[model samples]
Target: MTEFLDALVAHAFLQKALIAGLLASIGCGLIGPFVVVKRIAFMAGGIAHAVLGGMGAALYFGFDPLAGALVAALVSAILMGMVHLVWQAQEDTLISALWAVGMAIGILFIAKTPGYQADLMSLLFGNILLVPDRALVWMIALDLVLALTIAACYRPFLALAFDAEFARLRGLPVTVFYLLLLCLVALTVVLLIQVVGLILVIALLTLPAATAGHYVRSLGTMILIATLLGAFFTTLGLALSFGPDLPAGPTMILLAAAAYILSASLSHGLKQRRARLQIRDG
Candidate 1:
């Protein structure tokens, strides 16, 4: 840890990587709870995986991969949102198709693209140490966009997450808000790709928020705790991996998974104890 800190002090890349992680945490923290409450993790996964198709196409055609990813993510989110709203019965099948097709398209594009594709592995699994200054700037921009959107739509989003039908009855433009929420999730996924890559992105996105859910029932509190946990996990994982020469992305995910397991077990135990005590009192 000491060595890692010392290196961090000396390394501009490490500082940028750390900043990227924190920015990602902010996005995850804000949007993840709504994802959890609305049970849209699978849909988010579809968007995340679909991003690869955009990246692959961009790489093949000599465009910015991140820009391609942003476009793809937004497009997929809107398509999925419409399918979800109008084709409720076929939502899962359509989303699953999108998930599989997007990945398949990306792989094909990557295979056809000439050259070594040195960054391919990083795109799939992430290498935070390699994050460029441009990416950090992009992340900051996305973070601001995400924070502002959430701030503006907090109430409608809260209502959508808990009860979309009721919110619609109240004339809350449920469809628009639902689509907006999915788009936010799409942005969050893209924001996180540099930290954990496309494959492991969902884990980082949901795990901290899920763990926070075990401790708090309030959505706002869950977002706050999840954000803090994300920062801790990313920083610690980066530090630990730096000394051991481990892959940072997977290392961060392992830490989050372990924390989630511990939190779930403790929450379960407490619930059982409370139930037993109530029975005895009765």
Candidate 2:
């Protein structure tokens, strides 16, 4: 560990990865709790996958892939939100269809591209160490946007998450808020792709929040706990990956999954024990 810390301080790529992990953790911790509470985890996954269509088009057209991904993600998110508004019962089916179609479009475009795509695997599986300095700039900007937006509209989001109908009845512009939340999710997917890739982003987003849910009562507290857990997972995972030369994204996610399982099991066991003690006292 000491040697690894020494190397981390000595290396610039490692420094970037560390900063990237911390920023991504903070962003995911904040957004992920709302995602789980709102039951939009699947929709978030759909957007993550669908962004590939934009990436492929950008790759083929000699444009910025992240720009393409953001556009694609926003469009898909809006479409999904509209579908949910119009046909709530059929939204899942539509999301699944969109997910498949998006992936197909991306594959077709990539296949048609003439040159070899060296960064393709990194896009799919993620390589935090490969994150460019420019991309870090974008990530920091997006994190600021997300943080400010959440802070400004926290109450409306809380109402919407806990009870949309109530929020609507209270004249909170439910549709607008809901769509806005989805848009944020799109941005989050883009941001998190750096840390965990499109394929594993959802896990990083949810697991920390979910594990925090086991211990925290309020949404704010949950986000704080989740953020700390995310940082812990990311830092440890990156350090562990350094020795084995393994992919950091998957390593972080696997560690998060392990943490979630342990936290959940422990929470359940404690609850059961408390119930038994309560019965004995009675």
Candidate 3:
């Protein structure tokens, strides 16, 4: 363990990756509950992919890709939120339309760019080992912001999630909460793109929360457990990346997926055993 730690910190890239992973996990842990409770995994996917368009456009236009992702995510979140407010009829259609349009724009922008096909693949699939110090700073700030804001608004958010109707009856601002949730999710998506890219970002965000839910009843415990799990996967994946030369993001996602599968199987067997015990007692 000491030897592995020594080798890992020997390189500056590994240090950046470790710091970035820690920051990313903080935000992912905080906002992951909303994704699970609101069941917005699909919407998260749409948002993640839509950022691709933003990034492609940014790269084409000679701006930082992070700027593009933030702008696109915020705009998409507001517009997507408004769609449900306006029609309340075809959310899936509208979200899907936005997603497709965003991806189309990304593709076109990438195609328009000259002499750069493989260059952007790092951003697309997450090259954690390539993360720069400036980007690492941004991740840390965003993680703190997400964590603090979530902690402040947690109760109302919980109220909104389980029973929005009741929350509304109590004169709580469901619309504001809903939009706030979407905005936070957008910020989180942008942060995650740096950690795992768009392809595996959703997996990292959702799987840890789900696996933690199997054993945790309270949201606080759930978030803590998920953070630990995310950190574990990130570290292990980095070690594996060192060995197999595989991309870190997908390796981490696969690790998280394995955890999910194991948790689910364990939960199922425990439930079955409990049922058997109940029957015997009866």
lDDT leader: 1
Model 3, stretches more than 4 Å misplaced?
1-4
Could you arrange the candidates by lDDT from highest to lowest? 1, 2, 3
- Evaluated at residue 6, the lDDT of candidate 1 is 96
Candidate 1 lDDT by residue in tens digits, 1-282: 899999999999889888888988998898988888899999999999989899999888989889989998999999999889899999999998998888888888888899827778998999999988888889999999999998998899999999889999999999889999999999999999989999999999899999999989799999999999999899898999999899999999999999999999999999999999999998
Error of 1 at 56 (Å): 0.9
* lDDT for residue 245 in candidate 3, whole number 0-100: 73
lDDT, model 2, position 186: 91
Give a tens-digit lDDT track for model 3, residues 1-282: 455478786988888898888788877888887788788887887888888889889989989888899889888888788886786789899899988898889888988988767866776788888888888887887788788888899998899878999999999999999888888888999898897997788998899989988988888898898888888888888777766578889888999999899999999899999999999998
Candidate lDDT (C-alpha), each: 0.91, 0.91, 0.85
Off by over 4 Å in 1: none
Q: Write the per-residue lDDT of candidate 2 for residues 1-282, one digit (tens) a residue.
A: 776699898999999999999989888988999998998999999999998899999889989888999899999999989988998899889999998898888878888887736667888889999888988998998889899999999999999999999899999999999999999999989999988889999999899999999988799998899899989999999999998789999999999999999999999999999999999998
Worst-scoring 10-residue span by lDDT in model 2: 113-122
lDDT of 2: 0.91
